[model samples]
Target: MDFFDKAGVMAIGSRLRMLSEQLTEEATKIYDLYDVGLKPKWFPVFYLLSHDESKSITQIATEIGHSHPSVSKIVKEMIKEGILSEHKDKIDGRKNNIRLTPKGKEIAIQIEDQYLDVRNAVEEILNQSTYNMWNALQEFEFLLEQKPLLKRVKALKKNREAQHVQIIPYAPKYKTHFKELNEAWITQHFKMEDTDHKSLDHPEDYILDKGGEILVALYNETPVGVCALIKMDHPEYDFELAKMAVAPEAKGKGIGWILGQATLEKAKSLGAKTVYLESNTVLKPAIHLYHKLGFEKVVGYPTPYERCNIQMAKTL
Candidate 1:
């Protein structure tokens, strides 16, 4: 007859809150049974101060994952109850440090056995569950630290927008766009080399005249990315995929992937037997994109650029 019995996953937040209240009530009963004049909520701050007497309010809040206002309220109550004391920090005169009072220390020593019993009872209750809640919580916290929930959501939004972009062949108007985009990216990461200058300054002479092709990506009628496939002079019909760049604001929307795909298709259309690329190890996302496009690493590929430590090629 519990409301949560039918709510299922939709009421997960409520269910967790109800469980927390139930556990707190049980803990309160245990404290009353042992005649310990302490509140269940106050235990976390008190316990931290007991171990580290010189913790500031900010430090306690951070360690316990509680807000400053909430920790401040708990500290105020503890100070009123003579369970905690505060003093100005010697190293930082502006900061106030917290420590357990003499009376609080005495109470902590007296209730050590009771606290152990409480811990054992909680462990026993958790062992009856299908999964370890403590381990799961630790993992959840680690994942949040690695990539926050809001950041993941924003990235998903960017990916959706990126899917709607259109890939188009290079035009006269897009010539400035090609140089600006490539310069913005290159200058942000590394200095532009002579090879970059020659290709970017005159795409027609350096790329088009040499039997190469340039492709541009458009999002909302704005140029967001550009990539070039440069043909080699050898009779083997080899092409180098180079000068790929995406705008900072338009990145992470699959623009790079789209440009890479278009460049590969252009290479194939031009009768290229193999498509090669030179890149640095620092460009992890770019390297991953190349790998996704079936480009495997090769040794001793002659590159005109100084930053070209990684070389990869895909057979057309």
Candidate 2:
């Protein structure tokens, strides 16, 4: 590949000067045909208004990255030429809004055809491939005006950190910790015959095939709660949510709500339209939390599992 020398770069720049002069000459001819003088800078403002009917001058200036005063001056001239009009802001008494007048709309509509003509003329003169590359460069310049990638990453991290209770992607290693927490909850809150049902616990780790996950809540390194999603066999049912138990030590911290939200988000991500959950009548607080998160009563599907006591479904 041949590198562009300093003189070659200047030569290209000098050619662009001649090209811009030719474009302006051709543009003036078209304006005479349309009976209006259209400035190049006005094209952006016209296109913006055409796309979205109403916007404030401040919004326009911010979007196009021009000084508000400069935008105001150009808008004023366009208004005087009967190309645009101003209106008082209804929502806010302090601000003024701008929109294209009928004449402005007509000219803006013509700009589409005029721009095509200008593009074709340049393409014909500069060869088709060179024109395509030059057009791509212009687009790249426009994209450069957007917020940088680093700023977007910083914002995402900030949003993630502020969450009240996090539902991180589940790991298999927390099964024993979760079992311990459930056993403690049963012993402390409700008197059960046996809190040691190994078969009833941790079925997710040994589940069949796809779409199974567990969310465990932690309070200073101690696992406080566990929730699991079991992929359903029937297409109509999508997935079943089960084993939602919080530690007795970690009760009343709204961890259940967080678990519910996490479970729903997971179900949605897996393309599940409906999520069914089962709860025991003894856990009235859990039922209430389910209701708050938009669950509805449904006929309980017969299941041998001890955790599938009462049934509810949340449609995504």
Candidate 3:
């Protein structure tokens, strides 16, 4: 019924295991025909031992990507077959080094030519398939090295949770929250100037009265962050993303991201074609968040605040 095929990506592990078993069985038959006593599972450890004779079990396990217990089992089997021997390191009494025996070395020499032939045969078999299996496998391994699948999966889960934050339009009841959030951030890092005071004192007069919009992010109905899209009197359709702040307690929960996205969305809905932001490089996390939100460093923008030395903008 080809359950593995029906399961598709969900059955990848099981399908790979089946594939490995089939290949190992075929290789075992080939080894029997050639009178080679080596098993497919032992090849990795044996190959490493042949090249570097005194590697510790930990070293072999790390190089082969096998667990310590798995490598220990293979080592025990090889020791029983007289293919390997173990000894304590001369300087480090706690370290045990595995070495290939004289018989193992002799067998390696005998199979040297057959190893190349078998490799060529495998390559030919892979080439007969529709896809380039070797290149695909190499790319897959490289991607895993770059970012492990577990890390990627965890990040996806975190992002999903972050998306749970709700962005709500500013209301009179949340007015104090908007002011306090921005005031806390600004006073902590940089002193508030007259322009900041004007906006914080009366957001409705300075922001909304001038065709601007403010969006607040709430986690469990508690306001955690706020951002304002102030309509700019410029030649291009422009809006400044200002007065953005996430509470200290909610800093790492991606509330800043939620507020930034909501602000941009509000800007776009207002027929804005460009979005600009002013900040200081010292606010590294804020600067990083801006960049992630598609903001790019730009020059020749006037700033009303003394602390703003960095200007970034995005074409909506």
Candidate 4:
């Protein structure tokens, strides 16, 4: 057919808008034929008020899924047309309740037969189609409710950016990123402890020299995440997964997960039987990630950081 028709789902919004306008025009003709003075755009608000009692603008907007300003404008227009009236709420004097006027009630009674006829007509159209349009619309709406288009598009964008992320070995040049990333998150949530300063300030001296391994995740050749596998002396665990941080601006692009999976694989390759980690319950996402990576809660083993309230271990 045309360009928009050829584009199919890519032109869904424009196509749907056009379809809605077409239906509105046809509905207007039907309303005129029945001698009913109702606008298609006003049908949602009008039909709602006709069936229900007085409701505030906010209530109407919420129930009809229309914006507050939209409902307010429609109510004003209907009030001017002598189809609706507003009065102060009895329960809440600060609020106003809107209800159908006498003329609106009479019009509603007059439109009852037209509504039945239109419903049957729409059902006939739907049944004539190969796929029922009404059912498809409802299912598509439910899918959109589950994951809105905004969130879906954002996730796709993040995944595309994450494809540029590369995990590299910690080098002298990445020292600043390693320290800064850890310090930024630590200071934002809790006071930087002496242990934090010791490990972060001298990762090479305190961690690398003691058989620990540090991995840096680079996005577009810039260090954005760092995680260390610190060799532990504990009886139950071999290495402690510590000092993991992603740059604030680089978060939610799957950098942390990339570094995490790489670090775990490296740990497993180093003859490690189990990996340990300490975290607080407040960091829900981090805790969830740790669980997803096969870590389980543990009660024993003390932590040097005061902020750490939970301990976990993963068996390789």
> Cα lDDT for residue 274, model 2?
95
Could you give candidate 3's per-residue lDDT for residues 90-140 as a string of tens digits?
999999999989999988898887789898998898889899888988998
- Ranking of predictions according to TM-score: 4, 3, 1, 2
Candidate 2 C-alpha lDDT tens digits along 1-316? 1433546743655666777887778667776766656776676787788888889999999998889999999899888988889999999979888998998777777767777876787678668464566776677556645865456656675455325455565565776866666666666655443323632363554432355777777655566778777787875688777667877655656678777888889889989899987667777898899999898988847765454467888899
Screening candidate 3 with a backbone cut-off below 3 angstroms (N, C-alpha, C), the clashing residue pairs are none
Q: Can you write out model 1's per-residue Cα lDDT over 140-207, one digit (the tens) per residue?
A: 78998999877987889877897679999899899999999989978877899998899999999999
How many steric clashes does model 3 contain?
Answer: 0
* True lDDT of residue 147, candidate 1: 100
Backbone clash pairs for candidate 2 read none
Candidate 1 Cα deviation (angstroms), residue 212: 1.8
Residue 193's lDDT within candidate 4 is: 94
TM-score for predicted model 4 compared with the true structure:
0.79
Say which prediction, candidate 2 or candidate 3, comes out ahead on lDDT.
3
TM-score (all chains, Cα) for each model: 0.58, 0.43, 0.59, 0.79
The model with the greatest lDDT is 4
> Candidate 1 — which residues are off by over 4 angstroms?
1-38, 41-155, 235-237
Clashes of 1: 0
**Least well predicted 10-residue stretch by lDDT in candidate 3:** 155-164
Which candidate tops TM-score? 4
Query: What lDDT is obtained when candidate 2 is compared to the true structure?
Result: 0.72
For candidate 4, list the clashing residue pairs, or say none.
none
lDDT for model 3, please: 0.89
